[model samples]
Target: MALPVASPVVIRFGRLGDTVLLAPLLRKLHQRYGTPCRLVSLGECARTLYQGSADVAQVHWFASQHGWLWTNPRRLAVALALRSMREAPFYICEPDVRTRTKVRPMLALAGIAAEHCVFIEDIPLGEGEHWADWLLRFADLTPAAFAATPALDASRQLRAPSIRATPDELAEARAWLAAQGVDAAQPLVLLQPANKRTMRWNGVRAADDDDKSWPVSRWAKLASAILQWQPDAHVLLCGCAAEAGYLASIRAEAGLPRLLAPTGGLPLGLLRGLMELAHSMVSVDTGPAHLAAATGCPLVVLFGHRWPSMWVPRSASGSAVTVLGGLPHTPRVDQIGVEEVAQAWWRLPPRPVDIVPAAMGERRARVA
Candidate 1:
């Protein structure tokens, strides 16, 4: 089969973290085709998430979790939207069987055929291959690979799941941070203690039994400990407006000064700025954690029983990152103690910031 006349069309949908991981493949495909790629997802974040990237030409997404009645229309709508664009190669990045079946019809509705599509399940992963790396490898199968002259440093944007923030966005975020009293001259600690699984009650299971839960009380203690360790440090309980309630709970429980909650959730652009500006972060295995790592924020991430190598957020080269739990034998993230989190966070070599005298004294003794 020949390359599409326009560019590659990638169908990959995931939660925020999964969406972030898709960056590498889009980048690789764009370089190989010398064109910005079109993206399809099950959720809406991809647009805002990729707003600053030229590599993603457009993002089309709809709800996928509901029953067929609601989802099928959305699927058709997506197919209709893509139909307006030129024909392109389709890469289905999901390994899930149900998801793959769901996407096939969408492609069909768009008049894209099987030969033009590459289901990721067709490519078995190499031993211990992370999914992000697997996606990067999948990008190599494009017809562009056989050309005499290849892209310079072709497919080399593999370091981390990066998101670009525009200069205007960064400046806007800085102004907002300053207004919120986020003193750049002091140690800024960001915390992501809420996950969708735990935040929404499903009735069938307790949220605490899940991997994402680490006890809201425990989060309070961790925040207090951070404040105690660095009096000048500002702890921001970061999440979307929906999770503002959880943020409030943690802020109230911690009951200490210098901890602030954003009035609404941090916008994607501002969130990127926060990740870049923060000295470090502590989070459970979640989307913002992935985003934070991409921004080169030193991360102390708590993992569940799943294999860490499969889903752990990869920070930029040589940045501080500590992965605790996620071992095969690990039962749950709650099994991870508050002290363990603090120790891992303390061990991270502080990201460069203009430190106040009070915080500077503590960082020198703790970073080593």
Candidate 2:
């Protein structure tokens, strides 16, 4: 069945990983509906993450969800813009009850009928299905608010989520790495030692905060281990400029020349670009760790009690990914040891020959 000529709209407030996961549904919808989607996303990265992709028609982004319904002018403006496209079918991916409450009135204010919207909370997910798969399946679910919803795109099955980085973006990444004196001839190993909360607090610990971080000292130790086995390996400490001092301190703690921290953090596009060529990445569970998985970079990711499988970003590209934590026994990522992480990295399967550059090969390459 074909959709109406109206462009589809999707609502998801997501980070790099979420956006990466969102790609498949967008791809399916774009193919089925024959139009790109208008995305209502949150924060700086969601907008940045989809810059190179054709699936997103326009990105309506705001700083944060704080006071979004009343005080956020950007949110208000987006509602007004959607008012003009009132006929377009809107898919609400957010499952939070409070969020739905805020969204309902805003859409009503824009003169959108309840029948025109689809919400994911309408039903329970099938057993052992990935959230991305659940999202793909939920689009076809007709909301009780609407009579018979148009059968959404389900013909095209996305094996895994994939984000496309532009060729120009790849070139820029190479230039940036080369400028950083990153010798592309040798293996480029990335250590994404910081997650959003870790960087947000500048690695600080506070009461009532959820944490999924490996110790910086462990990160420092991991860097040394990489150089110990693979002397020529360039271990890039990944973080934003705000986390520069923190990453630098890790580099200093490691006390090794191979470990280098970029003065600037790896931006979303550049990070994707580099991941395509990177030998591997090791990190605590975070959005970029998901991004690495999507890009097909071999990964060793630490985890916590949260997101046993639902939030786990399995490699869409079928890249090797090693997970090291979960519920019952391993409550926090910090409980995972440095030696285990190092051994996991050692155990990661080699990058498939097709994705490898001419100069890129085995991880055991050593400097003379």
Candidate 3:
């Protein structure tokens, strides 16, 4: 018998990393309802998170509204589109109360009934609470359904496939590196010195605390250390063009060879593909860290204020060492010193030979 068609459920999550973290809950919703669920996302980043996922039937970009009614025709068009679809049960998934309060009225104005909405707030749990499991509770799933073990197991299978770089792209990248006398085949370590705009803490004004970023100097130190371990190991610095000058400064101070920032000027898809080819990735709590997780690349994630339990990758094999020693939700990377991050890197197990190599040579690559 066909399952009863309920109102369409819509999830409103803005950030890319948050959406990735919420994948398990979305999966559970799809399993339970087996209905076409729509996602109302904020921008390009959120759209990328849902890419290649079976859970989301369609994604609508949320536009700014001037009044209670959607002044933006695009939003009205989306509402009309939703109305055109079957009048299934509609649900708004919000894990935070503040966001729920802010978006609830807006959703209501868009015609979502209050009764159909659900909020999953900060509920207490015993030791080793899996947040993904906790999120399923809002959907009427039992504790068994909320179990993390199965979720983690499923994550392993759903890991994103490596973005395959075309021959022309590879040739161009290699030729550019070669012209600069950089070894194209050597093991390369990519360092992302900056987090996404939303994740960075601008610093506290109390105690005369000065604003700072996770020191670029620390990355220079790590790059030198990696090269000491493997003399052929080259360092590539990657980020937006605005970050290129910082990379240049770091390169000059460290006096190390610098490869082109693949992230600069490249489309999001291409950059992700190049990241898949790296030996290992080290990033502060950011979008690149989440992207690295999707590639199944071994990652050393430095955390200051965020809860690692709630945000860390689900794969057991993919290790995350978070230096969270402060009040919850207040991630201060300054509190996490260079030595602490170094220790985390030291603790990371050596990359398995079965994993993808920095240079895609004759070696057989592992299934990502």
* Candidate with better TM-score, 1 vs 3: 1
CA-only RMSD, every prediction: 4.4, 3.5, 6.4
Judged by TM-score, which candidate is best? 2
Ten contiguous residues with the weakest lDDT in model 2:
359-368
After superposition, candidate 3 runs with Cα above 4 Å error = 1-8, 63-80, 122-131, 141-184, 197-212, 262-267, 316-331, 337-340, 350-368
Q: What is the C-alpha local distance difference test score of each model?
A: 0.76, 0.75, 0.54
Write model 3 residue lDDT over 1-368, tens digit each, in one string: 13344524555654555555555556656665665456765556555556656676667765543344356676555555554433354555565666656455555555654444455553444345555455555545223222331222343332322322344444655665566466656655667776554222342123223222566566677767766655666667766655656666566667765434443544445445555556566776766666666655567776655566655644323433333333365456666665666666556554455445445543213212
**TM-score to native of every candidate shown:** 0.87, 0.89, 0.71
**Candidate 1 C-alpha lDDT tens digits along 78-166:** 87776655356677898889877777666666777555667788789887788798888777664332334255474367646767556
Higher-TM-score candidate of 1 and 2 = 2
Summed backbone clashes in each candidate are 0, 0, 8
lDDT of 1: 0.76
Between the candidate structures 1 and 3, which one is better when assessed by lDDT? 1
lDDT of 3 at 313: 49
